[model samples]
Target: MSIRRRLGTTLVASASAAVSLLSAGQALADDFSYNPPGTLVSGSGSGRFDETIYAPGMRFPIEEAPAFLNSQVWGHGGGSGPGGSQCDVENFSYPWWDNYCETRSWDMPLCPSGQGHQGQDIRAKSCEKNVHWVVAAEAGSVTNIGSYSVYITAADGTRYDYLHMGSVQVSVGQDVEKGQHIGKVSNEFGGTPTTVHMHFNLRQNVAGVGNVYVPPYLSLVTSYQALIGPPVEPAVGSLDEVSCDAIRGWTQSPSSPEAPIDVRLYFDGGPDTAIGHPFLADLSREDLCTAIGSCEHAFQVPPPLSLYDGVDHVVHATASDGSSNAPEVANSPMTMNCAFELPSGVRRRVADLDSANAWHFSPFWDEIAVSDGILSTIDEGEDLDRTPRLVATSSAPETLYLVDGGWRRAVSDEIVGVAWQFHPMGAEIISDEELAALPAGKPLRARPIVLRSASGDLWLVDDAPGPGSTGPGGLGGSGDDGDGATPDGDGDDVSGSCDCVVGRAPASSAWTTVFAAFVAAGVARRRLARGRRGTRP
Candidate 1:
């Protein structure tokens, strides 16, 4: 046999042994049966009872069925009518009396038209004198009480309907204990004459839609077995935890590849035990770094991946025993990649500006790089100062342009910094003509910007770099002069109309020479600054 199959067999054997040991001395009870109106039967009745009688933690509704005939006549397990006719065998349907027997031609079964009775009919002697008291099978509130029906809602949200009731004694909203009398059974309506019986029915609402009938007998049997039996144990198996680390990479795309983190668990138990129970793994890139020195591990998960960033997810596994459990759970940290560059020469990234909002943004970003003053302020412009103005942007239509921040035109700048308040996009360098057409408070062609706060509140900032200044230039540049020409070199002015320079070095030697020159210049400037400070002192 295969190893997995052998392991499964062993687990099953072990669990079965445990259950047998636990229930060794206890005897399972037989299902309850009503004595027909007339019959005589005898048996040794020595077989393991498979029928269930009660649910766990639930009580029987009534101590006993109410007396319908004289006490002696009721207790004999059967009854006889006038002239020595067998009453129990007379009116009782086939299958109840004799499995092979067929209904008499003159008699009508409960399901005469073949509609098939949805509920079982427990026959009563008479509708008037018997006074069949209806009781609740479990402790529940009387959710609905009417003359013809009484509905009891159990703690587990199951509703029991005792329909065709003569008159309800319980009122709506009444708290009823288990076995409390709610009403009396009567077949005064909804069935043919001489077929008086309590129509017990069970209906379950599927997904908040309509109700479907489930046999009451089946529910009763299952519930009864659960109550009397030992608690079912859950199965156990292998548990796995997976995670990913996203670090800065060579790619210009928003996503960057980092390290893989994984942990595996081996278990020896039942497989089904893990259902509904969450398996948790708390992992952080920092933790992995501390443990392994490098946050890299073998990939237990297959490629063409789905999850990104920090690695926390719930996992389900089947055990050797035909059972299953969720053995692995992972939680990833909130991360954001600011590698997205827009047409306006701006870059955008998300950050969990507030620690309190960590839960809100954790699902989207892979890594959150922390720095001082990543958040910016709101610039509502001078115009909307008196009015409560809010800025909002749609990620669609354009990658980072502002949609509305009380501005007429779209923001033509890339987002530079983001915070809970205002996020500063790139600076808007407008000409004197564009600035002059502003209506005092409102600037013409205002750069539209939207800012979202930790509280989910949105604001609009127009014509202002709300907080942080421009981002650092390309590697060769220092401050604003990086875009200037490189004298005595083949470096041409690649700066676009926006005054931003894009430089390209020769495939072989240009980058090396340029880098060395910048380094030398930086060292000389540092010495000069230190000398100036010392002279001042």
Candidate 2:
């Protein structure tokens, strides 16, 4: 006889026995009960009892038997016996067991060793011809798809395994919609009555058994919900500049070579509500670099200068709280400036300039004090003689000619004032020929190059040539001028007298008188020369 016929006969026999037991007043009050409920029964012997004999309302949980069968299928406890005795249950019964037996040693004879069946089996009736199609319970990415079995893992980490399938319809990594057909039920195991049925099981942690087994029904429900859930949206927010003080005590050392210079949105903005908490968002160094317009996050300012000199940066913060009511916070633009060096070796002032000090460095003229006899304002103003000076504007390769003689160049440790370097009118540029034609070594006094005004012009003054012609000696005119008196090489007595008086006799001596007389004479000559130069027009 076919397997289906055998299953049909078994069901009929069980039903008849159940009806007879009720008539005889031997029926139990439980939903489903066994003859001697807790005792084990043998598969081949007369230990078999009809399932329907216990209760009128109780019926097999599954409508049909599993299409696949295995002899090694046994209860949680190890057991073995004839005609797949493992199918029989004992005193302690779970909702899943179809039959019970007394001998713990009764194991399913059909299943192969080392491949023990993990799920339960149902009895199939011969008249039930259609094998139920296995379907996915939840929505998720199909992690593993196979011809005989298919497995899916939900985003929440739950896993579902479907075994004994004929043809898997989906491929690995495919996103499966809920309730999709995986495959049709196939063959059974061992030499049991060749019944057409399906065995279902739920396993957790495919990695190991420390994972608990959930009921097949429960798993199906959960998988169904996972596949149908709505998609998640990304959160948004603002990033703000952080004070150095906030990170002064940070313990985790940054792996990057650049020190931590910027406060990220993750660090500056509070927590993201979408993710459910505040996190140092996993941002790549490239992202931060693009945001800051710098090569590295941790930048080093020149010694003593704590201020940052760079473009203003804006950080974007996202809300973490799931509430739609929360608004995104954005940080105001933070401007960095060059830092100042302190007297002590400790570099302190390297920080963002306060709002009050964010003025742009004009390419025009401004008066600045000289420190240690060195001119400090080179780009902003011309030399004292009103000549145009060439100021190095930017590090980029573009050449900026001195318009109206005002150009500034940042020289080593000082802003060297340029003069007499005017951009010729109607000429878009000043060529190398023109630059060379101008004074080579002489300082060119220049009028501050102004689009509109010319207040900060610089003038190139003629100073005597020689070792003593530059710096303190050249400027103070203390060196000898070939003649015995103070050096008056430029014929200017005002600067020469001061130099002459130093290292000389007191005010009352003959040398003092001689020096005064000579200085007065030199002053008259200088005034005449200057007047001539001024009136040359």
Candidate 3:
């Protein structure tokens, strides 16, 4: 199989859950950015690497590469040579430039970084400097711009570092977008420059340990495709929300004006369609709207269960630098719908804590998951559709589903945290805070649940049946319509009346067939007797 396919097919451990978000925001929010338990190699780094930790919400570091990279030439999995070492020279059949987390670099006594490769190594199509622009993987403040290295720390404390940078564009303490150009690719170690290759690494904070290295091969490989055309964010909810009052608003990308970040919207994850007429005076988000310029586009919600068929859908948004080629997911926030569906028969009881609001529900589905954030019933597979699943209910053994599972919120804005999980019962809402407290790499306990909504309504999602019906009794019992509206109430009577009674069959009608059978037999016997008497005379 091709290298990228191999990497993509090898599903990361469930521990590597969540690659994107389906929130009201427009940007893509993924669960785990770099695929983890990343092929561990002993020779890439010249030092002791910490535990294999997954960093969620990361972006690919390289901004511009071929739309489709030569997967066969270079990718994860080391090259072969003596002792399966020498990643570059070992595979004569394969190009030397392609290697990630390779064990071949183990004995590079010259490279004292570590024993194993801690990051992904990327080389431009040909040996060229100041051509391939390496950008920030995700928007974050720059820091620790070293001699041959640079680090961009995301708001969530996830860190991205690039090595072998020739000319740096961003300074420490500066903010950047997902694909903002930061520098050119070249060997930059001050004294001795190695190959003209950019070695990329990621550092995510573990529970007790801090900033451990994870492989960026898959993340890089995936991001490499953004150059192919408008790339759909693999996971959803990576977008930022553009709020307006009339259940509608016009949004633009980059929040800039200079070379206003031009973009195209792939509504419902369809082909890219040019959105909006031109850049209007976008005063939407005065704070983070691009400084250069932006375009204002209007989006309206299709009717429920009608827009994209009532199931949650997405708008795979890709922002560009107005150039036909320089497009990526940097400034634009893809949007998702956060749909809230309530079950019938459950009493809208108030929770113990809040009073005014009853807990209605809003499940989060991840593009249009990017567009809206609400969730719907699980798909045909019953698998958790949304990455960083909103509610992974244990419907079957070892299977977590989004259906009958989601947040208990009356409104969308009430939901919080970088990620979330819920106990099957409504008793507790597992926040990221609680997750940090728990032991890492351990399974959360499963329980039948009753969730409370943001409006204080109790969501009885337990497997057991809900409280019995309180409607008008069926003819025989007390004919009270539980909510105090009797049969003779002064309301427009919408209830239909029945002509036949629900109980007791009529006795005569029931025995009609049997009575007919007896009479026919008697008549036959009498006719026979009369015929015999006449013949004898």
Best by TM-score: 3
- How well does candidate 1 score on lDDT at residue 24? 23
Give the C-alpha lDDT of model 2: 0.29
**Candidate number that wins on TM-score, 2 or 3:** 3
Each model's TM-score, in the order given? 0.28, 0.25, 0.35
**CA lDDT, every prediction?**
0.30, 0.29, 0.35
For model 3, the stretches where C-alpha displacement exceeds 4 angstroms are 1-60, 67-100, 104-115, 206-210, 229-420, 424-537
Question: Candidate 3, TM-score vs. the true structure?
Answer: 0.35
lDDT of 3 by residue, 1-537 (tens): 432232244323121111110111112222112223233223332233223223322344656433111111232222221232111222212122223334443532212343455566665532344556887777677988989999987655667888888779989888777678889877677777354457777777654444566655555544443443364422111123321100123334332333223333444532222222111222223333344233223222211211212333454444433322333343343444422222111222223323211222232111011111111121111112122233211221111112222322110110111012232232233443332232211111111113333343333322112111232112111212131111111111111231211232222221122223223222111212222354463
Alpha-carbon shift of residue 439 in model 3 (angstroms) = 30
Q: What lDDT score is found at residue 117 in candidate 1? A: 30
- The stretch of ten residues in a row with the least summed lDDT in candidate 1 is 247-256
Candidate 3 or 1, higher lDDT? 3
| lDDT of candidate 2 over 283-363, digit per residue (tens) | 223434455442223211111111111222222333322221223434422322221111101111101222101212123
The lowest-lDDT stretch of 10 consecutive residues in candidate 3 is 410-419
How well does candidate 1 match the true structure, expressed as C-alpha RMSD? 24.8
Give the Cα RMSD of candidate 3.
Answer: 25.2
Q: Which digits, one per residue and each the tens of the lDDT, describe model 1 over residues 248-289?
A: 111010011132211222222221221121111112223334
Please name the candidate that would achieve the greatest lDDT relative to the true structure. Answer: 3
